[model samples]
Target: MTKKRALGFGYLPQESKHHFLLVTPRSPNEDVAVYERFDWDESENQETGIVEDNLRVTLDRHKWNSIKDFLTTSFNNRLKENDVTVGRFKIGHVPIERLLGKEMVLLMWAIEDSDPQLISTAIKNWSGLSREERWWLFTMANAITGHADDKRGWRKAIRFALTENPIDDEDKSQVNMFEMFYKNVK
Candidate 1:
């Protein structure tokens, strides 16, 4: 059996049981931030000696909307404060039915380090992707966010989402939610 390589970006999470990386604006002068999103892969994290003093916020089932509002406002307000006319990070918790305009999409977009052509081409051609590829991406998103309740399981899920193909026989319809969402994103 081959070892599964977790992919996507990984950052250190906060010490609390529920933590998420806060994507903070760099300064009051710019909308283009020096920081985008934090990476969250916990397995290699421990191996690299990053198990402590790291944090991101996590919300219970109830706090999703509120936190989403806060993050969106934070991203928006910082831009306004800096007098930026474009480039907004209106990120928030997305309802399963709504499609894009959620943290998932924002995170994918905020990958400032990925190949620009890759990102742009991928996004542009999103609707053109095969059903299986779209399903894999959505399943990856679900796997990243909706996995086991513990930190380890959470980390593992994060790794899997980043590194592997999420396609499987389970939840094909749910996966299509992402497909519909991505097609409507632009």
Candidate 2:
């Protein structure tokens, strides 16, 4: 009894309930009604998109919800709610939709101890590590996130660490986010 709303790679059954979605891989934007006659199942949704293709990001429903909230609260960024355009917002010159799905997988490995809580934990995990370590994380993350142009892998992670507003205060120092996290990490 839920209304399907187009959400890029899939259809979010109801905007009010952002838990899970029914994906239409073959025809992304059409009203495919993938779950029309059948009972809705999360595994089925995953099979149609994530498992088979390895092109989409697949996480437990609960984890996915947490990821959304974490992205909004911690980074003040979103995973591009509207998936109509392939890469609505660019992350290191790569489309967010395409890059994020895989980057998330890499992020998981980076913070294996943490489920990428996406707040202080993720920042701590990244900042606490050495530049060489961060570089390793970046290279690995980029490999999964579909290598960016001009070897901008580092920029992808840095961009992921970006905030909504850089110039929030009078002082320019306050705008640089990596230093802020680096200070907090130490």
lDDT of each: 0.32, 0.34
Question: Cα deviation in Å at residue 77, candidate 2?
Answer: 4.4
- Tens digits of per-residue lDDT, candidate 2, 1-186, equal 332233333323332222222232343233211111112344454344322222223233433333434433322233233323221211111112222333343443333223344434444443344445544554565455522222235444453543222343333322456777799999
Assess the local accuracy of residue 11 in candidate 2 as a C-alpha lDDT between 0 and 100.
Answer: 28
**Strongest candidate by lDDT:** 2
Residue range 1-186, candidate 1, lDDT tens digits: 332221111111332222233333334333221112224344543224222333222332222322334445543443344443223232321111111223333333222223333333333333234445544554454455432232344344433333232333343221344775788996
- List where candidate 1 sits over 4 angstroms from the true fold: 1-98, 101-113, 129-136, 144-186
Residue 34 CA error for candidate 1 (Å)?
A: 15
The best candidate by TM-score is 2
Clashes of each: 17, 1
